[model samples]
Target: MFLPFSRYLAFALLSIHETVCTELGTSPFNLRPFSINLSSGVRTMLNKIKTTELPHFPEYPGVGSSFGIDLNTLKSLRKEWLTSFDWGKEQDSMNQFNHFEATIEDLTIHFIHEKSSDPDAIPLLLLHGWPGSFLEFLPVIDQLVQTATTSLGKSISFDVIVPSLPGFVFSSPPPANWTVHDTARVFNTLMTDVLGYSTFAVHGTDFGVGPGYALYDEFNKTTRAAHFVFLPFYPLKPDALQALNITLSPLEKFEEQEFIQWDSSGSGYFLEQSTKPNTLGLALYDTPVGQLAWIGEKFISWSDPHAGTGGSVLDSNEILRSVSLYYLTRSFISSLYIYAQNPHGFATEYTKAHTNAPMLFSAFKYNVAFWPPALAEKVGNLVLYRNHESGGHFPGLENPSALIEDLREIGTYWTT
Candidate 1:
């Protein structure tokens, strides 16, 4: 009787241990010596989560027509990547900018911490969004530094910090229940604690937009100001706006149209990212061609369709370079995990939070999303709402001179 009871207890403990390890993306059947001692009680609480399967890209009639790049050309380009691309060369190019990492709370954040040789440089934080790394802003750094020098004076250059967002490239994934706000806090530490800057200006677009504001909130007293290419659709709760007697103007009506378009057309990536990133990550992780196509679809839509915007909206060379970073680092899944396990209600919470600081917005016309000047004013101060005749999401990359000039003008108003 004693032997049978002991065997039953051992089996129960093994089951529990397996459950716990599987839940956390680890294998439980390791033959390692360390597996022998875990208490049955500790393992019982763990639940296994099944990773979902990603979807197939359905062949569409006009998909290739969007970029004017024929199927044959794309096929050949992909072949070249498999045969000729050098990730080592690309890695070296990325390292050309100074690199630094800082641990804040639960994260080890990787960033390009480029301090201008000019001693009087202003500290500027540049944040990148999903599918973007520090390299996204590389093409335009010179222009930005120049703008800072000219507007803030030669003595006033900019020390720029561009971090890989949590779950992106070099940064680690979020802790158990972390949200974008949590990511923002880490960034604040980087700014205030690590870099030792009491005040700095900030800029971001896409998923990076929200954190940019959080940085402003974190540095409420001293952060000079914040700027974003993508602005949140405010008054998060539809019912609340009705209760508050909020009203939007004619321009607001037009901006709403753009917002609706974004939701309808620009949201496929959002849906997949927020709900099933892990599943998609599997495909991206295993096949480089699949990863390129996954990212290539977005590159076409976001950049000028004609490729006129910053070298074909994205060059074949650049896509491979970007994808290579994901592949070599083996970060595709971990990075995508940020979207999968993002804190459940952070976006809603952020948009609806009660903050009295008036907002300043610059809405570009061709951006995938933007608030019409009228709607933005209704939401906040909307200090600068200018429509560009050209340029899209990657404004700085697409039209550097125009973006620099605009930033210079916007700088004068905010810096004072």
Candidate 2:
């Protein structure tokens, strides 16, 4: 799980429309809420799929989709996409939540702002990582805003702010030199200045861990706490763990091997996306099926096979919805910009610990990136940590209930 420590200095967006950046200071009035309907161009592209064809894939594999996404799965997804997947209905469902666009730092940031009726609801920011969009949060956004009284008899709810990290969906792209640090700064501004929250709790996974940690480190006074499903910085090495008189549990050892296997077979996209984005971006920008196979591979490889939210079991419909949105908005490539702009993929710092903010981590057994709790505790003020046998990378999709519970639990530590 250990890579070079210096690489994190690099890893770090695109716009749907042409919103020019003017010198306007941040304000809530600058934001506009609206519904997004499928455009004529996107509708035509989806229609063309019925007649257009995908080439056949010759059989060559031990496991289906192990080397890459297998052909059979790819075709199956396309079939579901054409038949049962309804983008208009899905768009209507998404629009039910309050979606907004605001000009901040010359970038038109897109986000889902769901506020609970509870005047005392905890202000929380939920950040999504790569291989996901703001859509990933759709399953749980409504649930998160609902009032919940924990088993401990504590009542809690959230004013959830889920922003599309600069270049992913409708949000504008960052400048070429921007990194996650820049993202952290802008997001801090969004929460405190733009939305005008006095304080907020943060949760992150995958690519989100970078900016989430950055907010925790830099804006200690405003960002009260953090909960993460993944930490870019890893736990201490096995030898280092032993020297520290710590022993790995059987599950930890097994997960470590699984993590290694993932690096070998499942992570080629990271390198290509990080090192040569433009070359790869052009190749799949327009081809729907191609984009499907490319992004479709990760949802299968990273999830707990039996896991997901509600009836939405991270199924073909769900997968295609993700790819289709990215394809239609022309953001599949723009999202990849984070990789190239920040080449420090998994090599984030493991040694430094900042305790100003209370840190809670949700450790899923199959997350691919494994870190022991003992070493993880050294990274921050480890207040609450839980391990789950279910869910993988995108908990918002895989286990919305668990993700929601964790966010509520973390919110309790915040004081007025």
Candidate 3:
């Protein structure tokens, strides 16, 4: 929470430099500091789930029973969430960081901005995916903002910015005509106009990857660098993979098999959200437990089994916090619209073109799509690519320390 005097001095110096450089261009946009204040009605609904009567059916037999979140697991989680969880404390903890809202092209965008005391800290933008809020990055946020010296004696720090993507929780919903490209333009304004950062780095996962890629592709001059855990685009064909001139290791082969299995059995959510989000969202909107079952399934299944032995790789509180935000803000339905808006998917030839800006990829061992290092090169000016042994799709939550360390390495490519 506190930086050393030397580190504080470094931050102060950088802050002065940033002020001088950014002050030259007056921002056309306005950014107002905001706070989280859950309404009493929403809080009451979240707390009443324990007493609400849930539908019951006879347990199905065999492996098929695990096809969805087991009813008992939901019941137990509901009990704990209502009885043991404390939303007030959690809200206060989140409020500890700086939060702001900016109206970008008529839509209100909510974000957390934690400026490092080290004036030289690189400005970094973090994007979160579906079923995830800014909460995903909370575990590693402090480490990123604090000044630290790496093993090689490199001083590393960042001016961290984590935003709720359009229509996710606090952020306003995207217009019907809006796509990820539109979101990209707004976020670009957010960085250069609202925050007055001339250039910044980006990291994204899941749905966030779409906007992240859009920013890198469409605004390479200002988006100086990027890192991604998910690229929402189609994987390269076998022939194309062969063209990369790299052989797959046994571990890589195993990852391929896992991906195949996942695509076959685990992608139903995609179809529903992309095609008929409203139909399902309306059905689940009134029932908190229903939303839990729908979103909680992915949190449990998509995470690495080895990451946590309990119900999910993420703790109960983490999962509930995400769901609670959606419920309280009434953004669950709008969040699903991102899938519908980008029906063609994000793998365009334009996105595939390489940029001069440095790009990095961190492929988690248990991620749904296993993008080999060879295939990743075709996408960008690939500078750093690393594979982890034990994280899944939600690395920010499943493995924060690893995510933080990888993000810190991005500073190596930062230019003045």
**Best-matching candidate per TM-score:** 3
lDDT of 1 by residue, 226-259 (tens): 6666654432232444465655555544444555
TM-score of each: 0.71, 0.88, 0.89
Candidate 3 lDDT, tens digit per residue, 15-76?
Answer: 55445644765433445667898856556776557557875853664553258887777887
For model 2, the superposed segments whose C-alpha errors exceed 4 Å read 1-29, 47-52, 57-63, 235-244, 308-312, 353-355
Candidate 3 clashes between residue pairs 3 or more apart in a chain or in different chains = 11-117, 11-118, 11-119, 14-119
Specify the highest-lDDT model's number.
3
Q: Per-residue CA lDDT of candidate 2, range 128-152, in tens?
A: 8988988778878777778887646
- Decide which is better by TM-score, 1 or 3: 3
- Which prediction has more favorable TM-score, 2 or 3? 3
TM-score of 2: 0.88
Candidate 1, superposed: residue stretches over 4 Å from native = 1-76, 83-86, 147-156, 234-259, 308-313, 342-360, 378-381, 414-416
Cα lDDT for residue 62, candidate 2: 59
- Which of candidates 2 and 3 is the stronger one according to lDDT? 3
Model 2 clash pairs are 7-344, 10-342, 11-342, 13-167, 14-167
Per-candidate Cα lDDT values, in order, are 0.58, 0.75, 0.80
